[model samples]
Target chain A: MATTTTPAATPGRTKGTGKPAGPPGRRPRRSLLPYLLLAPAVVLELAIHVIPMLVGAWMSLLELTQFHIRDWSGAPFVGLDNYRVVLDVNSAAGAELLRSFRVTVIYTVLSVGLSWVLGTTAAVLLQRPFRGRAVLRALFLTPYALPVYTAVITWTFLFQRDTGLVNHVLVDQLNLLDDRPFWLIGDNSFVALLIVSIWRTWPFAFLCIMAGLQNIPDELYEAAAMDGAGFWRRLRAVTLPMLRPVNLVLLLVLFLWTFNDFNTPYVLFGGSAPAEADLISLHIYRSSFQTWDFGTGSAMSVALLLFLLLVTAGYLLLTNRRRNDA
Target chain B: MRETATERWTRRIVLTLLAGFVLVPLYVMVSSAIKPLQDVQAAFTWWPRRPTLQAFVDMWSTVPLGRYLINSLLVASVAAIFSVAVAIFAAYAVSRYRFRGRQVFSVTVLSTQMFPGILFLLPLFLIYVNLGNATGIALYASRTGLIITYLTFSLPFSIWMLVGYFDSIPRGLDEAAQVDGAGPLRTLFQVVLPAAVPGVVAVTVYAFMTAWGEVLFASVLTNENSRTLAVGLQGYSTQFNVYWNQVMAASLVVSVPVVAGFLALQRYFVAGLTAGAVK
Candidate 1:
């Protein structure tokens, strides 16, 4: 995993080059070029990611609000106060944050789970060549290909109560429900958000899993079949095991992307998501931008970042350990 | 391992179901765009009753769609081009050279992908404001600011993927070029780049699509004049009503370039994206 993830860490292998290594100081002039080439990316990464992260951590300690925004440095220091307010479950802000956190957890889990399942299902089913398979594969990837805003905005329209196709199918056609529930607002907004999220993300899972499927040689399946392993048994023994590495990375990527997703909820529900469907990203956005409480917002943002870092670290560690065990 | 009739039917059924799920929103968008405003505002219809292209015409005038489009194009294009250029150099260095801090650089860039954009939003906003005040260069509510902010969003992935892509091009090529007195820069541009064009295109499309679809930053960063389509498209729905037809029309228009580009380069994009995970 480390070797694959870090391309630079792997020593370059020169093909057909029998030449011995040059003297250590032979290429002094060329040494500077790498640094020169790297300077722009390094500088931009610092400005865009590193510096702002440090500043964000700093801002988390200050009572930065609309009042102090113009001259944020002058904002009074309030170390841990923002964190306390947001993390204390008894407090309104904290309670709301907790609710949003729970919602996000549920949303991420369900979205990731459903997307992976759908993606794997579609990929496995379409693994073998069939009629119109090319068209179907291309069609399946359309959602992922479409811009996030365009796709979600279209969803917002589809989720509309009075004129929505979702309700029309469920109520008018399928007779699954008597009432045409308000999808973009109230409690159902969460469900609406989840649907759009699954719709948007499942295609990516499909693509990744499909690519992974190609790497699994047919001999594995043929061997499984020689052992009298049926379709379900063959899939379990051959397909899933071979796809483990891809799944490990795919699941983690999906988890991170879906967990931190802001676009789908923000666009589907507009800027201010309903409490029932408030993701932490939008919650933090509303905390700072809407309420002008940059301090608390930054605190929440820092917390979210820390939580994600922990999850990613834990995920990588666990996967690496499991791989070692295998 | 030949599938039985039952298995064949099951595959077809599942595929059809999944395809419907995938196509419904797209079908709705295309069908709704042609519907009359009243028809779209009323009960949903499987097909448009009164088909018209009025929404397509009205979309441009409804908001400053043209201005927003231009802003999106400029921001996304410049960001993509700059990101690709910077990434090519950095990727080359990382791929070909094992200098000090290379691992740290690669890891730092890769780890940035794990951080949420919201984490940067508040502080970046403040930095822009404070920097603007102190340095007399406006970053808040400015296109320049947005572009600068958006650079890192795709930089890490671009670098990571390009490194993988560049790693595939044999070192023999670079060694041969170097032996012939071609410098690293000349080898990269003339030798490696031509071979890595597909990877560059994939990265460009990814970066462009990212910038195009970005909502969180553009929401906070850009004002009306500088608003990209991601934020500006919300104008279609004011306090009074939502122009659903026109919104759909505009969505189709906005999505065409990206969707088409993505599908066209689907093979390379998939290969580049999955290289890290699969390998």
Candidate 2:
């Protein structure tokens, strides 16, 4: 919008200056300035993201390994063999990858679902002012504001088998369980990862939902009340519908971030996560870094990227269509 | 709407429960940071037997905590400054001008946010190595390499959010500066940027925090000399024992600046983040 009006004004104002204005001397310079301004971002993005991605795709087809890392050009180009090895269900790598994928999917769903619910509940409850609301709001956002490593490291300390407060509460104080459970390892690792993920993420959801609620008119709730609607009915009709746009973007972002989360698992489990909680990001990290198989790791990374891209595209399309239908 | 006594009780109970959930780990971090090392490693206690700041004092000697802190500070700050400076110009361009390929540029930058960091990690690592080999400059385990890698993390969101922020600023102010014979750069820096201080602060803090907490790249990219706190802190736990108390102490020290900065500027940061979506 600024573009349409500004360019027209520029030419007209320059014409009134009485210069020979068949493409003013400043026109080319002006046109080039935007590109000049954009140059740093473009170059950084290319060097950091775009070129790396293209190179990753290329590396997926090569037999790149630690042995060949210094001189990757010498690594033989293996046509689709890395993909075949990683995708074959019968193979160990493929089986592990599939299992990791399943774990990640379930983890993402639960983390995103629970986080959204908690955030929305807190936001709606806090929407109308009450005593100590500001303190509670700030307190709730503390986890999100804290560094991920610090928060997860704290969680790790709390989840320690012998000395963790979680077990101390559940086993020692509350006497809920007969045995002290290990949180950062084995079957319980999934639950631990999920709890930390939800804890770290829900505050973000609350922030977004709270921001979204500010835009919703109080008149809607009043109208619903006048229609003899109860709180639940008002929430269902007025609150949820009005929060759709926020929910759409928030949910998608949460889904992607949660799915691709490397920090929570990495810090909580310390690089090598248990099979139960091996998020795909960390799994790929181990595959590449641990096994020193850059080619297969790059293949898995490319595959994961494609899957995420597909999900994002589909999510946008579905959400856009729903908005149109509504 | 007015709430009944029953509803009020439920709200209070839920609020307390959620607050406890949020505060417990933080409580643990603070409590553990002061507890004696043996008290932390031996048993989990709600109250510290002998609470002391000895762990805080010991944390520095236990590892290269000071070096890690300095490295993290330097890397995160430099990356944040560069990302913000670059984003300001790019955001201004996208916000104020019509250019060929502007839409493609915007979309590409935004879409980069969706791709997982792992997708770029391996290749970026390789590129650093290869480029180092070719040019005789060490990027594989260098601070400059880490800073470059970190730009990708913050630059996209910085540009996107700043674009939204700049769009909200009225174009007339810049136009008035233009009519006053101020060039575009001058109009941007002297005229437009003054009004967008809050937005700039928000972006800078976001970028700094992102670089500060990042683990994935920091893990692989940095070695001993250039190790950041994110990876360096893990050194406290050796094969034989874990210095839990010292780790907690160090975590708190590193977390203070970021958490305080975020909470202080929470309003502006939230406004900048949700501006594009909520509108």
- My TM-score estimates for the predictions, one after another, are 0.94, 0.94
Report how large a share of the reference interface contacts model 1 reproduces.
0.69
lDDT of 1 by residue, A172-285 (tens): 999999988899888899999999999999999999998888888899999889999998998899999989988988898899899899999899988889999999998888
Model 1 collision count: 0
What value of lDDT does candidate 1 attain over all alpha carbons? 0.88
Query: Please, what are the lDDT tens digits per residue for candidate 1 over residues B1-279?
Result: 789999999998999999999899999999999998999999999989889999999999989999999999999999889999999999999988879989999989988887888988888888887788899999999999988878778999999889889988887776665554455676798779999999999999999998998999999899988999999889999998899999999999999999989888888877886665554
Model 1 misses residue A283 by how many Å?
0.4
Best by lDDT: 2
Clash pairs of candidate 2? none
> What is the lDDT for B165 in model 1?
91
- Of candidate 2 chain B, the 10-residue stretch with the lowest lDDT total is B174-183
**Which candidate wins on DockQ?**
2
Global fold similarity of model 1 (TM-score): 0.94
